[model samples]
Target chain A: ELVLTADMLVEGVHVPRHVAPADFAYKALAVNVSDLVAKGADPTLYLLTLCLPKHPEPGWLEAFTSGLSNAQADFGCSLAGGDTVSAEGPVCLSITAAGTLPAGKMIHRFSANPDDKVFVTGTIGDAAAGLALIRKEVSAHPLSGEGAMREFLLSRYFRPHPPVAAIELLRQYASAAMDISDGLVLDFTRLCAASGCGGIIEADRVPLSPAVSALLEGDAFSLEAALTGGDDYEVLFTAAPGVADAIRSAAESRGLSLHCIGSIVREPGITVVGRDGAPMQISRPGYDHF
Target chain B: ELVLTADMLVEGVHVPRHVAPADFAYKALAVNVSDLVAKGADPTLYLLTLCLPKHPEPGWLEAFTSGLSNAQADFGCSLAGGDTVSAEGPVCLSITAAGTLPAGKMIHRFSANPDDKVFVTGTIGDAAAGLALIRKEVSAHPLSGEGAMREFLLSRYFRPHPPVAAIELLRQYASAAMDISDGLVLDFTRLCAASGCGGIIEADRVPLSPAVSALLEGDAFSLEAALTGGDDYEVLFTAAPGVADAIRSAAESRGLSLHCIGSIVREPGITVVGRDGAPMQISRPGYDHF
Candidate 1:
């Protein structure tokens, strides 16, 4: 087959209006590309079905298209066809990307094994923190006059660097891998569900930016929020313990951080453990698109 | 790649609510499959993304999925993946059907010949009349019993039995072809535009169903409506004049109609002529998304 496609991105739901147009296009294509990446497919071609605001400024379109072009060039993909429509409400973009995988070699969500070391590429919770900071800046007081923290948070919320290359690399050794768009804990739960297994997650071992940590030091609930918040766009994979060293080496070779945050187990439910070994559960775990 | 993709069908756009949900899924997937058919791609997999009403009835979903399953089986495609979400307003369905094309041999839109004979695979105006009939039925009055006009219009409007097999067979000989989703005149004009040439279509040679003819006899504008109204998923192609007979013969062998609507001219614009060789123009020509 020559196509792999999916569409979905509603304004105010998948993204916010405050985001840069270029970032919107980048994240839009990235989400679709991540689906292809999860299947161990290389990006080949894409079509954009855009429901844009009427009378969009030319600069916005230029920025958006430039972002799309950059992502396309980076992944060696081409734009083939698409539809553009004027919408009266918030802008919506639905993209379908098609890629090729070796015949009979496509990876699915299922197929995991007990004792596989669960790994995550890149730091988590940045996007969630960024959104929080944006809320604070807009609704409350401006936070520190566009300093590093604000810029980092806004960038994370805007252009989520999709783990396309990392996913492609992990496809070779990992039994199951998916981008953490819908938060770590929830997505990990889904991965476990798909593979018919449970997981043993370590709370302290999970990476968090210092800014996120500084915002609420003792609020353990916030840690769960970071775990369950969507839009991180980092790759979470599972590999056998024997390959942990190799996974770390491989990820480092590509200038990516590979953290052994947890492990797969034979049980059928999630159990998150703090440093002292007691199980912990927090509310507001993740998003569900009902 | 093992994925097939397409775009969203918005309410008040793709179909009417009076139409059954079963037909909605069929039209959604069929139109997408028509694209693959034009590429000589074999349908094998599908993924659907739906933006639905707040509380869609089970009957609607069941009928929709049934229609999708039917199309998949007919085309030998599998339902591989999907995501569904509730929208704030109006229902939308995005379906991507994956199909394989011979390596490095996929057909594209920009490959028409200057001296090719133009052919359309089926009758064109039935779908437009079908939409008209649907509007009339809803606002005017329902005809008693399953009247012939009502049944005919309903079939054309709802289940647009696109000639996929005919398209598959014609792909071998046709230089450039595409499904006529946006009215005959407009779509044919697009073909000419893509091929970088002109066309002279004979108005008298344009096929119309008996119902359309009846509707047009007392109304000059109804003919224009039938000519330019959109959503006819028929194959339109151009080829060398020398191969026209063989093409017609091949179509006939498969129990399909091959209409010789006109000739691909050397000029640079689309022109339609009546029996008296007078220039023709129709109002409300084709569909524009924005």
Candidate 2:
């Protein structure tokens, strides 16, 4: 089946000013591949369009393509072809990625049933914490006293490992699926909206990496960002209770950790239960560019 | 076979400052669809990425999407999906279009052989002449004494009709093919390079629209620009002598006019035969963004 998606990263907007050229290139491809992973589609080919500066620095294109090639190898996709043009504006990259799934097997964000269990792959909020660290919004904290945890959070924001090998299990088990991009609350809310269902998620049960746990040990702001700061690129999916064992086995076979954080409900909106078992007040559910 | 291509139009680079937003949007999709036509690919789907200003003018998104929808209908393709982001830089649009051709029947830029008859579809240099007129490069040419010719050239620059219906015939008969987006001379040279061949063309035989002919009757600079100015988006193909009848039939059936302008040669470069049947010297063959 034809499943196509386009994603763009604009210089100074999506990427940081001090990002390495190689990292920029890798992000360009990785982000698009992440979309395919969410759909449980086998990555096939991609078309990259670079709107670059008039006079690029020496070796910039080489580094950029090197990163792209590295990601292509990493994700099992080929660079079919691309267009490069000199933009008198800031550098921007646009990629159109194509992938294929078995007929009638693509999981949709709107297919979740009220009784389905909601699960998210990998740790959440590490990227958000990492971004805070990079921005220097939060310096040293007693919670993240270890240097290793700090480095882990920082790296998580820069690169993510999407669970590509679990596509079979996901396709078989997931009643609904989507990638976490614009924050957990927002994206999950979107998922609920699409399925015409609602969910109740336990905040404490949301998967958190040691790095993120340490970084935001006591900061409510950090907690909020973790829930609403997006860019995680982790797979958020739902499955029926009968297939829980099979889903766990599939994820373990790929050496991945999947966490069950909530369940779809008959309610019309999402309700986040805090550690106290009461609905937590949310100021904003997600990020919006417009 | 999957065929994909990308094209970008950066504000102030691809479009003139005086162009309307609607025209800008139309040109963005038209240029990319043109590439698919040259490849004899059946239009299927396209993804659009718009790097727009943070605060767009009222009705900008509607106008832009309207433009995209119009082109989707105009080119017989679907807007599968896309990404949108705000860039502080100038407005830039990147479109990745995907099409399919019969298995193992797609034409290549490097497939032309020696003695292949080289032909270009439609009249050449009209877009270039139109652009010149828009830029006031040629204000009051005696040949284009009427306003109709001026309007024709301007319209040609703003919108191009890629011969999408000619794909079946092209796949059956064409050995090599490419679109003329970056001037006839330069793209043709690239085609020859890709095929490890050369070509010779009588300049007077290069089909020219009445508007272009009238606009460049007395100005060699204008004439040269018309020949090498690019943005013409016409398919250039090479076919064997036996396929000439088929080529004519293909064009007539599609209501398109194909012009035989040159022939592939064993020699390794291009030669432009003037009206006097002598090789003419060229200074700049085409525009290079780099």
Report the TM-score of chain B alone for all candidates.
0.90, 0.95
Show where candidate 1 strays beyond 4 Å.
Answer: A1-7, A53-60, A103-105, A137-146, A218-221, B1-5, B17-19, B137-146, B218-221
Q: Lowest lDDT 10-mer window, candidate 1 chain B?
A: B137-146
Estimate, for each residue in B154-233, the C-alpha lDDT of model 2 and write its tens digit.
87888777777777778888999998988988988999989999998778888998877766675623656767887888
Q: Give candidate 1's chain B TM-score.
A: 0.90
Top candidate by DockQ: 2
Residue pairs with clashing backbones, model 1: A3-B3, A4-B3, A181-A231, B4-B96, B4-B97, B4-B98, B5-B96, B6-B96, B116-B239
Q: Candidate 2, which segments miss by more than 4 Å at Cα? A: A141-146, A218-221, B140-145, B218-221
Query: What are the models' TM-scores?
Result: 0.91, 0.96
**Against the true structure, what is model 1's DockQ?**
0.44
Candidate 2 chain A weakest ten by summed lDDT: A214-223
Write candidate 1's Cα lDDT for A33-83 as tens digits: 777776678878877777666688769889889988877776678887676
All candidates: interface RMSD: 2.5, 1.0
Interface RMSD (Å) of model 2? 1.0
lDDT (tens digit, per residue) of candidate 1 on B181-224:
88888888888888888887887888776656656663522656
